[model samples]
Target: MEEMLTEAACRLGVRGAQVAVLVGGELREAATGIANAELGTPMDARTLMQIGSTTKLHTAVLVMSLVDEGLLDLDEPVVRHLPELRLSDQAATASVTARHLLSMTSGIDNGFYDDPADYLATLSRMEMLFAPGDGYSYSNASTVVSGALVARLTGLSWDEALRRRVFEPLGLRDCTTLWDELPYHRVAVGHAPDGSVVRPWTFSRASGPAGSTLCSTAGDLARFGELFVRGGAGVLSAEACAAMHVPQVSLPTRRFAREWCLGPYRRDFGGTAVFGHSGTNYGGSSTLLWAPSTGVVVGVVCNTPHAGYPLAAEVAAEVLGAAPYDVEPVTRLTADAEPYVGRYAACDLRYEVSAVDGVLTVTLEEVASGRVSPPVALLPLERDRFLPERDLSGGRGWDLAFVVRQGRAVRLVSGGFAARRMA
Candidate 1:
């Protein structure tokens, strides 16, 4: 396992990497490369590496634990708990529920924030991309708000609440919400594509609940994954555990399974059902995969941006004895494609749909940068749904699904956020 990880990291130009696998009730671990390139620190089992959004799983677990205690209800509105919660859309601010936040369907705009203390204020000033529960849009603000709700309900800071509810319970001594919080000397530093160091080594504390600021070793992550494979025994109720893994909303990407649960992305590999989450940060990527039937959990982390998935997938395939699935082919465009060709806007993004040469394509424009992504071909999936011929976000495939109203497309839903049609 160590050799495989080392080879994968070296081949991919990853500065540092770690792998931990749990099989047959035993935990096996391996590490290779440097933790800190300047200091020439070698990677090891105890080295702390940022897990990014995989921190969502821990936050979800904490929320579910509260649900188990009957102190919170998933269906309750966010405003019900945090009455001060407000968004640019008053209705959505009042209507959004905990479930919506957990399912990534809160419809709130995803904004750029740098301070943990500013999360609530940032959310208050943000506008809704769509109505709550209207569609799936992955928003960091939604998860950070969820963390704030947890803090309010527990009367503790988000970090302290996590420590009391999750870390201590799971005996995750090495896991922490921030890199600077790590007591250990061995910590992986992120490196950009050009091999330059990504300084600061951590995201703002405000984004900790959203995946910007959590750090852990591969072995610790594997142990966390193992709890799910075992049905959430000591941490969450069986029912709560099942709920977290069940598909709550359909995802827009083909790189992952079509559906996402409360925390992890759900998918089937080689007919084996798997649930886990992946994380990406400044110059690091991490993945945690678990197959219940095989009782196998695989965790992989790397200190280079977007380089962790291949290694993690390799480990998962080897453990489950499965090969990678082929990409879904594009289908013929339908006659009803006219209704879907239009302009849609959400937050700082604009989408223009058009048909040329009897083929349909969508162009995405970033409002701030005025930078337009290459027009991506859309393959018909259903009457109002289509899959991009290529993954829109590099290796992660994002699909397009139109929301129709009064027999005409009124919105474009993809990448977990809805874009309203602009007339």
Candidate 2:
């Protein structure tokens, strides 16, 4: 396992990483690379790496624990418990529920935030992407608010609640949301694509619920994953544990998954379904996956940013002994193609889907940098979905999907976010 870990990290240009896998009734572990590239500090089992948004799973478990205790209702409007929550869309602010937020359908803009301390206040200046429960847009804004609600209802700060209910109860030795404590732990710093240390470390404390500040070793994460794998491990109710993996909403894009649960997104590989969440910080990425069928739980934390998926995916396949599942491509268009062609923008990033003489293509652009990518041909797929013939950056393709309203694609959802159509 250590040999495989080191080989994968070296192959992927990862500087530091840790992994923990639970199989049958035994747990195995591995670590490779450096905790600090400059100091060349060796990564180890005790070295903590930012779990990134995988923290959302812990947060969701915390939220679900409330449901088990009868302190919160999943379907009840979140505002019912925390009225101070407000969005630019008053109705959505009022109507969004714990279910919607946890399921990524709250319509809150996963807006850019400057300060974690202003997490809730930042909402007042932001707008909703869609109506509550109307569609899915991965929103950190929604999760932070959920954390705030947890604080309100538990009469404990979100971190405190997690420590008291989860970390303490599960006997997780090294997991924390507080950044000040990182100095005392063997924590991994992040590295950018160029292999340079990431500046400003992290922008996670304020987005704790959305998974920015949490850090842990691979073993601690795997143990927490046991909650889902083993009927909540008696920490949370069996019913609530089951509900978190059940599809609450589906993403039409292959970029994520076909569906999302209360916490993690669900995907199938080698015909076996696995539920887990992947998270990315400034320069790191991580994933925690558990397969109920095999009773296998895998946790991967990589300090090398932006490319953690391949590491996690490879590690999971190695542990699950999964085989490749080939998917036949859809060559024929099944839906009206006209409504899908449009220009969409999220801040300075742009995507333009166009049809020229019957050949459909998408042009990606970084408007702020005045850089435009070569057009990539798009093959038609079912239900208004499009498979990029190749990635905009010239890598393998990821399928794309749109949110259509009144006969037009209102947004292009791919590459981890939904870009609003620019009319």
By TM-score, the best candidate is 2
Tell me how far the alpha carbon of residue 351 in candidate 1 is from the true structure, in angstroms, after superposition: 2.7
Best by lDDT: 2
TM-score of 1: 0.89
Per-model TM against the reference = 0.89, 0.91
Residue-wise C-alpha lDDT for candidate 2, range 270-371, written one tens digit per residue: 788888888888746888888888899999998987668778778888887783343545563334568878888764468888877666778989755789
Mark the regions of model 1 whose C-alpha exceeds 4 Å error after superposition. 323-327, 330-336, 379-391, 398-401, 404-407, 413-418
Question: For model 1, where is the 10-residue window of minimal lDDT?
Answer: 323-332
Worst lDDT run of 10 residues, candidate 2, spans 391-400
Clashes of 1: 4
* Cα lDDT listed for each candidate: 0.79, 0.81
Per candidate, the number of residue pairs that clash is: 4, 2
